[model samples]
Target: MTVQLNNGFLKQQTGNTIQIDQPVKLLVVNLMPNKLETERQFVRLFSHLSLDVAVTFLRMASHHSKHIPEAKLQQTYATLTDVYDQQFDGMVVTGAPVEDIAYDAVDYWPEFNTLLNWRHDHVRQSILECWAAQAGIYVDFGINKRVIPKKLFGVYRCEIDQKTALTAGFNQLSMPQSRHATLGHINDPRLAVLASDPEAGPVILASKQTHSTYISGHPEYETNTLFNEFNRDREKGLPIQLPKNYFSKDKPTNTWQRDSIHLYDNWVHSLKKVKV
Candidate 1:
């Protein structure tokens, strides 16, 4: 997963060379069921950047994971107390599988709220993905999520709304999305919609005041991520559909990786400008 930043399309924007005197402290609060797989996915994306990033994985103290073994969690992950006093250059809150339930009803909702508040003060830039995106908008702005009749599961074409650094190298972007809930009508003037799709609604939102970015789709998903998910659900006899625009001749492919890496690269580039 070595990404040549000097390449034509993926070339980094012209700017001062990012001073790598110290590795950027990146914290990923992973709420996905498969911790190790999620970690590898994110690390693969981060590894593409030219910057030296020291990534720290965080787990919730209140909600015990059913999928990952407790010993693995104990051996590899950190709780909030471990990094409570530390500030990070960037942080990522991954989407959890508990989208159907109310935010308050989740077991670790209270603890998550505490973490979000702490991030507001400590982190320079934070990305909230999927469920975390909905939660962030609800916490920051009074926007609520509405349940769509069917799961919005597929790779949808998104139109970039603004020419911010986050969306610097993109025109029309294709992103992978899997979620049961979509954000309701947003009325907050403080929040800016960055990218959107006709079916997926608001796919990206950014808040200048908080320095927070919310992404409704999983741009970090691997090439076969949606395929694996679809199979997993189908095997369990759950209702599932073929991921749109993801397969070529009804077969899975890795077309979205280039754009995904480009988006993440832009994010890392933005972190370099932060005087944290």
Candidate 2:
């Protein structure tokens, strides 16, 4: 969220360059335990886009995050109250680790819902990634996410359907999915499935009525994300299997990173210019 002022950026503004426009304002609601890592992943993709973006990392005000230090949490993250009066060009709501828990049972459920309700008006366009995507779908379309028998973790090739700006120029794309809940049967007219895999089903969905998009995979995940997660689960004695189509001889090749970058670029391009 912090920007180091550089010569070129300053020159562009001071010299009145024709190409520069107001920086895109983006709000990221991070729900993961490793906040710093999540921040890194999202920021990496955002950094690749052509537009200059100003990002705000927001945390649930009511929930206490034990993973990050209290001092650092207060310093680095924003409470919903901090930016309630503001509006943004776009918002990114990341997935949480609480897929198995019922939505109402999560400690910050009320606060999360409050944020989503507020985003409907304040954010021009938005993305619901991973678990947040399923939650958003349930709230918006009255659909429920069923817990799958196995964790759907790995790189998957999804066939793109409806050619919206979000999925334009791609017949199919590779995505990294790491979730236990799946939208069993999406029989709603309000939402359109942009891409689907045989096993992963709907990988991307856009609301026909709203400016929000829902993604079932974690395109922001780095190459070793699933690798680290696999080890972490093993250390804790949690039941987990090797991620499908992810590992090769104990190493992972980044097959989905470029596609992920383009995916986010498309989302950024979909946003209209908003105030600084």
Candidate 3:
């Protein structure tokens, strides 16, 4: 259950050995256009933890990806039908680029609904990120996301509920947020607000029944994610503002998000404790 690492090559952690068990099977439903980059981001965060997690990427069978090559998708990803009878300890639904559109308008909305319903029986714990968070809330609780005046594209300071297992070690957390829509008001009794920000509203929401976690911000985002998004928008002549608290001296540099890593570590621990 434990393994040692020396200081020579593995520079991320110092000390001797780390404890690990049988690798946790995680199903990742990637909705992002840039599938490979998103997968790498999640894998990078998951690798930092002591637990070994085997991730299986799931692509939408209903929606065809225009950005990623068809051959690559066929080779690397699995459809819902491929793993319909299988179950996982944890499932992650990534944020998509379809935030501007209505939930019913998206091509994969129906398929998404099917997947959400399936998770009730197939998954032990699920984490929905950004647009998928909105979708999950709307599908399960009938809470619709509202359009914001400006895109919430920046690194925000969030107040975490330290008492929650998902955020046990985090007091205040900084995460990357990039979305055009916001979960305006959630009045569901089954949902608990785990974290929030004045600018970003509800950063984290947890469901009492399904043990599902929803995150409006991208904790798995790399340091330059927001900076790259800002530049991309600017190049396209889109009205974009500088990501707050991201670049020091207004210059893009690698921002070490140690707290984000801890947040994920806590989440993986919580998943491991689940009785399934």
Candidate 4:
């Protein structure tokens, strides 16, 4: 991705500072068409952490963007080749809408694999969300994503499995999920389920060392994200299920969903504590 520096956002590095060469660097590979909103989500999460984090946005070169402004995409993001040699404290790969088809069908499959392989060697830790989580399972462990009979919609409760750092303080966190595809039975030996629901698929999983986080639900979603998705699909005449327990009195306009934001904060705080 292009490394265009944000002039005002960049804090000047001082030689006399206590931790002068140790600022945490995070690279966010945003696959969402709404790049600005995705950027806001990451910013909101990172801002709450105690660490000083500098984020670099990475965009896929293989796909054309329709919703994002051309100038913003060009100015903020770069192709995978642009960040190959960089070492980062953490990385986040956002979800895309390509789960219905095979990964090979997407134009950037090869590039995506390259990014994953590079992360395996270079990145200290990484988070994969939604479809990106499915992609990780497929690529790294040969696990396939199965198209569910119906879309998994709304906010669901996730009980944290305390075996890993990702759920260090999480007890029963509710997360927002807005997606059409879900992973089927995963028989991969390298993957471990971290959180699950009897009705929904496993909401969280990780590789053995907690270096990689694969979350089926979107903990980073804003309160209005589910509402926005519902409205968008409704306008487009696409089939959408009402989010479970999302609306107050079954009315979308009456209540606010505050659970996602809280859950996301917990996840970020926990991730910040992880040592490589």
lDDT of 4 by residue, 1-276 (tens): 112222111212211123324456678888987776777776666565555566677888877677766665665577677878778767889998777788899888988998898897778778899999989878878778878877888777776654565665556767777777787665666778878876677888888653788988776777678888888889999888777868875555312134444444455455456645
What lDDT score goes with residue 268 in model 4?
49
lDDT of 2: 0.82
Ranking by TM-score: 1, 2, 3, 4
Q: Model 4: which ten-residue window has the lowest total lDDT? A: 7-16
Q: Using lDDT as the measure, name the better of candidate 2 and candidate 3.
A: 2
lDDT measured at residue 273 in model 3 versus the true structure, 0 to 100: 85
lDDT values, one for every candidate: 0.83, 0.82, 0.81, 0.71
Model 2, 67-123: lDDT tens per residue? 766766776677889899998888999999999999999999899888889988899
* Candidate with best lDDT: 1
Please, what is the TM-score per model? Answer: 0.90, 0.90, 0.90, 0.83
Which stretches of model 4 miss by more than 4 angstroms?
1-21, 69-72, 250-276
Candidate structures ordered by lDDT, highest first = 1, 2, 3, 4
Give the poorly placed runs of model 2, Cα more than 4 Å off: 1-21, 273-276
215: Cα error in model 3, Å: 0.2
Collision pairs in model 4: 1-78, 2-77, 2-78, 154-243
| Candidate 4 global TM-score | 0.83
